[model samples]
Target: MSYVSRNKFESARKHIQEESGNLDVLGPENRSWWRQKSKNKQFNQSNSSMTVETVKQLTKVFCDDEALINKKLPKELILRIFSYLDVVSLCRCAQVSKAWNVLALDGSNWQRIDLFDFQKDVEGPIIENISRRCGGFLRQLSLRGCQSIADGSMKTLAALCPNVEDLNLNGCKKITDSTCQALAKHCVKIQKLNLDSCAAITDLSLKALSDGCPQLTHINISWCGNVTENGVEALARGCPKLKSFISKGCRQITSKAVVCLARFCEGLEVVNLLGCNNLRDEAVQVLAEKCNKLHYLCLSGCSQLTDTSLISLAQQCPYLSTLEVAGCSQFTDAGFQALARSCRYLEKMDLDECVLITDATLIHLAMGCPRIEYLTLSHCELITDEGIRHLSMSPCAAENLTVLELDNCPLITDASLEHLTSCHNLQRVELYDCQLITRVGIRRLRSHLTNIKVHAYFAPVTPPPSAGGSRQRYCRCCIIL
Candidate 1:
């Protein structure tokens, strides 16, 4: 018998013997009965041992069968598995015991290598080795947060991953239009691209991207300061199938370019223009009219947007699930009420820094958007304890709420949070910068909640200790408090 089967048999026999009682009978009839019982026990032991041995043999046979099946798996299955694994995990899999290593390093699995945060000095040699091994199979490459990657390394990647599609060079500060031009020439299959926070990228690079990749679906050029309205208009005209676009912090993009994009990209689902100070209500009105299928809209820091614009959005895009108007000082309670009434399916809503919103708006939101799972009212000066109490007391409070951010809403005190102990499903709660909440309230919450995570900023004043003689202060940003 195999080792596993032998071990199982021994264990089973030991357990059976332990459970059976040691008995002694004096009569002759009793002796015959004991002999019969001994025979039955021996028969059961033999049968069980054989069964275990058979099962062990079958398991080994099945594992071998699975290995054969893996060898014959289609290319699509390999790519799907590759997509599930990060770059580091993929590389490690390529070094896992011989057979698995070969399967992981196969050409089909090397098509998309997302080396996010690939450190320069340490990761360069590894990437070079990977490029040498599977250069021809590489297609989509993302090197986001690689501060050490320079023009030379990018050129090498472009040369190696020739059929590259969907390249994200976000935070690659050293990259310039020259690198873009090189990619345009060599990596013609590029589709989705993210140049966000690339300070050196200009309209020249965007132009190259437009000319090279005609099948682009998503693009994020946020914080790329040099991109103008002209480049944006050109992109709108070039990439018709674009579904998601984020140009937040690009000060040069104007209403004209935005209108053109809204008209051209009928399939657009998500559009973020946050921190685009130049974009006014007119631009938003145009977007609301044209992009009816918009589900996610971020107009945070668009200080110019007002209730009129939000009303237009509610009327036009009824499917909007996420709306962020942070730092838009002009938005009042009426605008939020309109949103709560219209967008009943809203999952996330951020009204941070909108000082005009009060408890009345929060009550309206609690009553209207019962499906809301995430709500943020950070720095909204007028929100008070009553508003938060209303939210915690709502019917949807106990089941769906996962994240709640009430940072900087000063009027919210311990009484408000005490009412939130019923929110059993709450996963994250941010109470940063709230001055009124004390350690006493936190202790009470901790006693009830075992799994909930609380992030609160402690107040400067020390409160009096309880009868127990000492008080425990929950520090600010203390998770799982």
Candidate 2:
């Protein structure tokens, strides 16, 4: 009686009485219960007269009242059913009825809320309400790109949902170390954290995380300039389970922190140190030697890295599938050949602007890595049609190759297009600024491979050399170089 609300009871009774011949089917016990309800009073006294009507009423109480039966299902089962619905669907469900409203907004259903799509609509008060409603049940929450959230909202979340494990505040620039401190003091169960482009963060925030969130596994502190080697070293020492660390553009991170990470976090699989200009071959060598599980590495713009680091990776890191050494001009064919010989599982390779790689590197990759799918050789001046021909004839080109980018390889000509025709698996091809490739070549290539997307922009036509244009030609040459 107490489990079913008054409104629900009245609604069920009205429906049953209307369907079952105007309460004629209702037993005396139900009749008396209805009479008490209709009189706007509670019936504490019981009538113990055994009759057929009384038996029917008891049967109805145990088996009928469809609404009550539905509501009587286990709350845990209901919560499990609601878990598949997203936040927007849950909001729509809350408008169904009073009972549904309560069930829809239950903290258990709102545990993992992702407001990334609705970031603009989520203000501080909205976050506060959600935090209050969810309380300790909230585990994973993403407020990524929600720039409206400030320190107070984060503090409220820290106070209310301290059990939260995965929190993504990426691009929330207003948050500072204070928010991190609050989260550290309260959310001890914190695990995966993404603070990408959060400019206000510093080593203080990382220190707090080191002290509190020892359970931290994955963290992205990219573009946080104030975070130095000290913070990274602290995390390396504290969080042993840390696997993936992305700190692109964090200029303060150097060999010291990277070496510490390699020593402590041997299970690290993905490490992106893009634009960490201070990192050199020594740190990378240590990483390749210790972190055998490393699968993805991005050292783009780490200019200090020499062929020694690549050689170390070639010898040690066999599981590497994706590598980005875009601006590493110091990388040569010697290092690349070693890498191609060892890392046979290489799927994506970005050697953009590694100007020294020539036919040797391409031959090594084409013959070794048949699983190679995506390859970017932009600005590699040394690559010619011969290297491309070798790659096009390789097993990778016939079956697995999908995306091929050759943005500024000036030595490539119409002959490369002829070779690419054999690559049936080619899906997207970029040939911007290849001076000798004409529209006719691309047209022929497209006709041969109808499924492939060929992107070949013609270079600006230069007029016949005149006295006044000789300097212009020199300048154009300079630009291409």
Best by TM-score: 2
lDDT of 1 by residue, 202-233 (tens): 88886786777678888999999998888888
User: lDDT by residue for model 2 over 1-481, one digit each (tens)?
Assistant: 2234456655776787687446345556457866765554332224222345435654655344333433455657656777789999998867755556777899989889999998766799999999999999999999999998999999999999999999999988889999999999999999899999999999989889888889988999999999999999988988888999999999999999999999999989999999999998999999999998999999999988899999999999999999999999999999998998899999999999998889999999998898999999999999999999999999999999999999989999999999999988889999988898989999899999998888777656687677663354467678889
Candidate 2 clash pair list: none
**Best-performing candidate as measured by lDDT:** 2
**Model 1 whole-model lDDT (C-alpha atoms):** 0.77
Each candidate: RMSD to true structure? 11.3, 11.0
Q: What is the lDDT of residue 55 in candidate 2?
A: 50
Candidate 1 lands at a TM-score of 0.73
Taking all chains together, each candidate's TM-score versus the true structure is 0.73, 0.81
